[model samples]
Target: MKTKPNVLPAHNDCPQTTTTGNSRRRKAHRGIEMLSAMGWWSYAIIIVVCVLGMLFGLYIFGRSGSEASNLTQLATATQRAARTQAGFGTANLNTVLYNAGQIPNGWTYSSGTIYNQWNGTVTVTGKTSYFTITDTGIPSSECISIAQTLAAGGVANYLTVGGTKITPASDIATINTACGNANSSVNSTTKTIVMYVGALQ
Candidate 1:
């Protein structure tokens, strides 16, 4: 009896997928994570923009007319102040000027030998200064336009006919510009700016 030997099937060598496949898998995972991070960052940016917009809106609305009520009350008090006010006494605004800040450049309180007595309805310009002055000491701490022309950008206290130093209820002081343009006032003396002191309009 001849017995034939059985041949075994050949096993072909195949490429193994371990490190390369793992690295590819890792890269794909990292790409997905990065996209997620980017999306979150975009959302964060949108939120920040919205918050900023709301804050700005609040600021604008808050500034609208909160000061009006206060000014009205102040006006009532000052208008009567003029009635009780006595005649003007002597006080060189210059003496008080130094107590204030430096006198503006190109604008001097106008050096004078005699102190200009602010009597009756005195204007704060020309003989005294080209800059006109309307006294809050007069009525309602009211700003009567100097009618000359100017905007200095500082404050001026009114030494009333009586003796009161009337301050504006609120513009901070009188502005030398005109109230016609925005909310401001001016004097007859051009370039002379008075402080604005009144509640915001």
Candidate 2:
């Protein structure tokens, strides 16, 4: 018998090992490109958002500060015009009335003598959006000047005096309507005269 043919490893019997190095490298490159593109877009978007937010904040802050400053100035002007330096007992009503001007609200002045009412006193009081000059026995004519001052100060509603409601009109007409033709007596009958003035809220 002839010698057995030389035994050689069969092609299908040996473990098959396939190399995927090229495919893996290609996939990795694609993934890296996608990640890089996403990172660049995200960074750009973040920067834009931050810049817009800062600009908006600055605008709001500036507007608020301006409004606050305007209010403060208004308040100061009102206080300066309304408050009197004269004390309660030593106040001169004529002088006070003469010096009165258009002023904001929240002012009061108490004086011992207001009209020729024999030691009668008066109180000029201001509410949140209105002002009142009150006296037990003062002539209604005294309110003319005061009303004019109030009007110049920005009062728009109807003014009242001596238990009468006076509708606003022209400067002269308003004064005439407010004071009227009737004259009140300075007697002990407690005839309170109140001059009401409307103010901005």
- Winning candidate number (lDDT): 2
Model 1 stretches with alpha carbons more than 4 Å out = 1-17, 67-70, 76-201
State the C-alpha lDDT per candidate.
0.33, 0.47
Per-model TM-score, in order, reads 0.33, 0.29
lDDT for model 2: 0.47
lDDT of 2 by residue, 31-67 (tens): 9999999999999999999999999978655543432
Q: Per-residue CA lDDT of candidate 1, range 1-201, in tens?
A: 988899665555555556988899999999999999999999999999999999986754432222122222222323222112331222333323323432322222443211111221212221222122333221221222321111121223321212223234423233322222323353222121232222222
Query: For model 1, what is the C-alpha lDDT against the true structure?
Result: 0.33
In model 2, the runs with Cα more than 4 Å from the true position are 1-20, 76-201
